[model samples]
Target: MFKSVLVANRGEIACRVFRTARRMGIRTIAVYSEADARALHVREADEAVLIGPAAARESYLDGAKVLAAAKATGAEAIHPGYGFLSENAEFAEAVTAAGLVWIGPPPAAIRAMGLKDAAKTLMIAAGVPVTPGYLGEDQSEATLTAEAARIGYPVLIKAVAGGGGKGMKRVDKPEDFAAGLASAQREGQSSFGDPRVLIERYITRPRHIEVQVFGDKHGTVVHLYERDCSLQRRHQKVIEEAPAPGMDAATRTAVTDAAIKAARAVNYEGAGTIEFIADASDGLKADRIWFMEMNTRLQVEHPVTEEVTGVDLVEWQFRVAAGEPMPLKQDEITLTGWAMEARLYAEDPANGFLPSIGKLEHFVMPDGIRVDTGVDQGGEVSQFYDPMIAKLIVHAETRQEAAEALAEAASHVQVWPVKTNAAFVMQCLEHPRFVAGDVDTGFIAAEGSDLAAEPLSEMGIEDAAHRLRHFAARSGDSADSPWHSLTGAVGFRANAPTRITQAVVVDGEAHVARMLDDDDHPMTRLIGLSVTRVIAFENGSAFDVSAFARGGSGAGNPASDGSLRAPMPGKIVATPAKAGDTVTKGQPIVVLEAMKMEHALVAPFDGVVGEVGVSVGDQVVDGAVLATVAVPDAR
Candidate 1:
């Protein structure tokens, strides 16, 4: 293997590669922009290089800068970890031209499958069934709408450039076609810098199944089974599992064959994935599967594939880049267990799953389960990158056991200050539909609110109250303590009937909590559930505090009040108003852009912007509002 390789990406993916490379005794280099100066990936890698400023266009997207970094670091090969330049055909070609090994598919393969429209055409030629839609080279809005009509109602308008659901829209009827097309084109242009689009027949009750394919310069290729990425939101995958459930032996063979066929059609090499949209209505029938696009690089959920096949795909990448042939033959590869991966994003599920940004205060990752994260506690989650905290992956003998493990793991994950979708992820893993193996692309959105519903026990409030009450009793009556008496000597004494009453808003309902704890009974009562564990933490100075978490039901943890904010880290594209500015409901306030996607922060109700803490182009995190609205008539 090569002595070293440079990962041309940031966040969890870069750190993930570094972990594998370090184990293989391969020195790894990380490239970071200004925003990622203190990012975990940079700190973890053996060597790091500064590429450019925060904007992806000037930094990670700059292929020449990456090549320069590789040369400067003496990196023998460059691994484009998933996003940034992973699927960029030109980047792969540039790396190869610079005499650096490209740890991905060949430039020809990338070019053939880079654009969805072109890839569909190639898949058709290769005899792999494709979704019947419009892949023609017509850019006009009228042309697209006409094509959608010809194709059928409920067509999906997808950006021909980027995948990750950046520029995708669904039209349920002909009347919604024009507006949806315009919006898709606008988002596509803003995100990918390409306004081109393709219309495809929307598979009702679609199941996203993709096969992992590996090849070498010797032209030898083999296929790894499939991953069911049916649990999705806004066209982006939220949860993925290996060896799709309910897939019979015949359909599995057919889908796997189709995936390999699509790969061989392009003469693919290195690690790539052929994604197919299967109509699950007929239970994964051979003829019901159609080609979706191919991912020309290592996938984010590659761990699930590894868990089942017991293969290290990154090692395979390194071997291939070093001019090695396929490591294992078709018959050698085997599925040993089931695996599931949940993308833990620093985004709020309650607030439409908007991106969240901030320092990870007391960030506690779930144990037992594998967590690949690029951020540590106190590291700033910048507004110039993806707000993905980590990928929580677990492997078990069976899918049910894996799901149970994943659910339990997510429940224990603690992200302080910044809101996360940890609880939301757990909810999905334990979702009955998911457990029963009856899920689809739209399952999450279809039943998301119910899944995110709050439990009635108010247990978390009771627990937090118990902990805070104990701290307040001995809390020195100093200026530092909010409840401290002015005398500066702890007003309340230890075990002296600590009387505390605080009201907190839970799910928009204000609830009052009264606690009384004395020497005889140090802990408070919850009517039925008893407080088993209490953790105390000391903040800056004399601000010592403790937290009580109730068991049995996860109802008492105090997290950021559910807020839809920035999803991934990015710059505030636009802030339209100042403090005290009255705005109507649905009025756009802050336009945040991350991963080249723009998300509009809208007003929840007709109210005045209370505070203008940030300005246009300001970098804000999740819940860090460019402007906050004043609740009407605060009585």
Candidate 2:
């Protein structure tokens, strides 16, 4: 085994790799950008080095800086954890050229699978069933459209060099093919610096099933069963599970065998994943599955696979890098129990899943589960990186039990100030279609509005009212109390009949709450001053209600004035409306890019644009006003 290894990544994956390396008695080194100077991973490593500025292109993506840091720290190997430079073939070769062990697959294997079109060709030549698609080198739009026609309608235009659903689009008809192709190519160039694309047949009802494969320098390859990642939003996975809920013995064998064959085809070494898109319109079957793509590094959802197979994949990566043989053969590996993982992101489901960036004032993670997090209480979630806060993983003897545990765990999460998708995840776990194993890529689009709905129960509202009274009284007695009187009455007793009416806003809607007494309540166990967060449990699920004291009833509403604000900190990509432009309700005014996604700010009502505060290419912070519109006169 190598004596020391340097993790060439950041956030949770870096911390995860360090944990395994430390347990194996290997010294770990961490590299960080300017933004991550005080990050948790930096504190956890044996030695740390600052590479460059906060921007990824200046720091994380710079291979020379990473290699210099590794060499300066005397690291024997470098582990590229999942993202950044993990799948960069040139970086892998450079590391090897520097006489350092590259703790991943050989550069040749990475190059073979780096491009989707070429990889599909290789898979087909190796007898591995691949999805029918156009992998030609012709870059003309006319050629792609004609190929799409040949493939069939409802085809997919995917970036040959894309992942994470960045440069992908589904066109259901010829009328939309041109627009879809242009959009896909633009995103591809922006994200991957490659404008080339491939057309494939889109499965009507698809289930994303991927098999975890491991190979060693001695030419031994084995599979670690499979993970069902059908629960997705915007073509990105939200929840993943191992030993797919409906997978049978015959189907498992077929997929696993095909995965191993693909690995051997590339002479693959180290950890890699072979992802397959199964046509579940008729349920999972051996022949219905086809190769989609291969991830040439450790996956974000690898924890679920580890939980089920009782294998230390990272440790295996180290061993394989040291030229060791496979730890366990295919026959020896066993799937003992079911496991599920939910990715908790700092995003607002109510606001088109826009990324929420701010300090985590009160972050309370649940116990009795595996939580891989990058931030803690008082941690800053900046706009320079992915907004994933943590991953909640649970394992149980049965799939139902695992699902129930994961949902309950998601409810126990307590995040303040910044919004999260915790509630949305809980809803998916408890949804009838999800719980009954009837999930697909279209599940979120079919039932997302209902899942994202924030409906406060009657009891929850009452609990918030009670908690508000408690906080108000607590604040009144403080030395720095802002109010002159607690209840606006002198010598008022706790049991007095005087009632205080205060307006509380929950999820942007205001509600009138009455506080009669200060009697202690069970539901008000957890309360905060000024801002009271009430967590209520219903039917074995958790719901969070944040109640903030409103300014007043007659106060001028911001919405009425037509002030367009930046929802989160981002750069203005487009500002279509100018000053004095007559705009109708729901008209796009400003487009902001943050957390790797674009969001448009729309006019709230039919009105005339009065002033534009921001211009294109300018950066703005959260809640910053971008434009203003004059309120339309009442008809």
Candidate 3:
């Protein structure tokens, strides 16, 4: 085993790798950009180095800087933790050439699977069934249009070099093919610097199931079962589980065998994943599955596979990179209990799932489950990186138990100031369809509105009112106040008898409650309290209620002022409306890009544009006004 290793990544994956390296008695080095200087991973490393500025291109994505840091720290190996440089073939080769062990698959294997079109060709030759598509080298739009027609309607135009659903689009008809292709190509060039694309037959009810494959330098390859990643939003996985809920013995054998074959085809080394898209319109079957793509590095959802198989995948990566043989053969590997993982991101589900960036005022994960995260209380969720806060994994004797436990764990999460999808994730896990294991890529889209609804029930409103009365009563009296003994009393007077009412806002809806004399209200339990916000966990969900004394100031509702503000900190990429322009409701006025996702600020009502506060390419913080609209006068 290597004595010292450097993790060439950031966020939770870096911290994850560091944990394993520490347990194995290997010294770990961490590299960080300016944005991550105070990050948890940096504080946890044995030795740390500052690479460059916050922009990924200047730091995390720069191979030379990473190599220099590794060499300067005397690291014997470099682990490309998943995202930035993990799948970069050139970086892998450079590391190897620098006399440092590359703790990943060989550069040749990465190159083979780097491009989707070429990987499909390789998989087909290796007898791994592939989807019907056009992988031709032709780059003409005319050619792509003809191929889509040949493949019938509802074809998918995907960038050959894309991942994370960045450069892909589904066209339902010929009329939309041109626009879809153009958009896909533009995103491809912006994200991957490659404008080339491939056309494939779109599976209407597809289920994403991927097999975890590991190969050693001794030419031994084995499979670690599979993970069902069908729960997705915007083509990105939200929840994943091991030992797919509906997979049978025969289908399992066939898919795992094909995944191993694909690994052997590339002479793969270390850890890799072979992803397959199943035509689940007829349910999972051996022949209905086809190869979608192969990720040439450790996956984000590897924890699910690890929990089921009792394997240390990262430790195996270290051993394999050190030229060791496989730790366990295919026959010895077995799946035990079921496991599921939910990715908690700092995003607002109520606002089109827009990425949120701010300080974590109160970051607390539930106990009795595994949580892999890089941020702690008071940590900053910066705008320069992915907004994923953590990955919550749960294991149990059965799938249903695991699902229930995971949902319960999600509800225990307490995040303040910055919004999160914890509620959305909890709702998904508890949804009847999801609990029954009927999931697909479109599950979130089909059931999102129902899941994201934050309706304050009558009981919820009453609870908020009770908390508000408590707060107002407490704030009214000082420590030496003579009326301090009159706590929780509605009209109890030390001076004069007066009826008091307090207003509280729950999720932007206001309600009023009369102060009661019950000092011990059994129903309202205050989990967290502050001057502005009060948090209570009720009915398996967290409710944040903002309370103020009657006629006092409350949380600002931006929509009430006819001003369109940036939802989060980001750069204004485009401002379409100018001052004095007449705009209708729901018209896109400003486009902001943050956390690598674009969000549009729309006009709230039909009015004349008043003031354009920002221009294109201006960096703005959350709640910064981009434009304002004047309310039209009634005749």
Best TM-score goes to which candidate? Answer: 3
State the lDDT of candidate 3 residue by residue for 274-392, as single tens digits: 99999988789999999999999999999999999999899999999999899998889999999999999998887678888887766777888999999987789998998898999
The C-alpha RMSD in Å for every predicted model, in order, reads 8.4, 6.4, 6.5
TM-scores for all candidates? Answer: 0.81, 0.85, 0.86
Clashing pairs in 3: none
**lDDT tens per residue, model 2, 1-635:** 88999999999999999999989999999999999998888999999999999888889989999999999999999999987899999999999999999999999999999899999999999999999889999989999999999999899999999888877999999999987787688678766789899999999999999999999999999999999999998777899999897999999999999999999999999999999999999899999999999999999999999999999999999999999899998889999999999999988886678788887765667778999987887677888888898999999999999999998888767676677888889889989999999989999999976687344444434445455555557644454342222221111123222322233333333223343345543222112323233333222223343322232222223455678888778888677799878999888888787766557788888888888899878999888999887765531
Return the TM-score for candidate 1, rounded to 2 decimals.
0.81
Candidate 1 lDDT (Cα, 0 to 1): 0.76
**Error in Å for residue 50 of model 3:** 0.4
Comparing 1 with 2 on TM-score, the higher-scoring candidate is 2
Ranking by TM-score: 3, 2, 1
How close to the true structure is residue 552 of candidate 2, measured as C-alpha lDDT?
21
Ranking by lDDT: 3, 2, 1
Question: What is the per-residue lDDT of model 1 for residues 512-604, given as tens digits with 9 covering 90 to 100?
Answer: 333334533333322222222222211100111222132233334564321335555456655766666778877777667674566777777
Q: Which of the predicted structures, 1 or 3, would earn the higher lDDT when compared with the native?
A: 3
lDDT of each: 0.76, 0.82, 0.82
Q: Give per-residue lDDT, candidate 1, residue 318.
A: 88
Residue 627 miss distance in model 2 (angstroms): 5.8
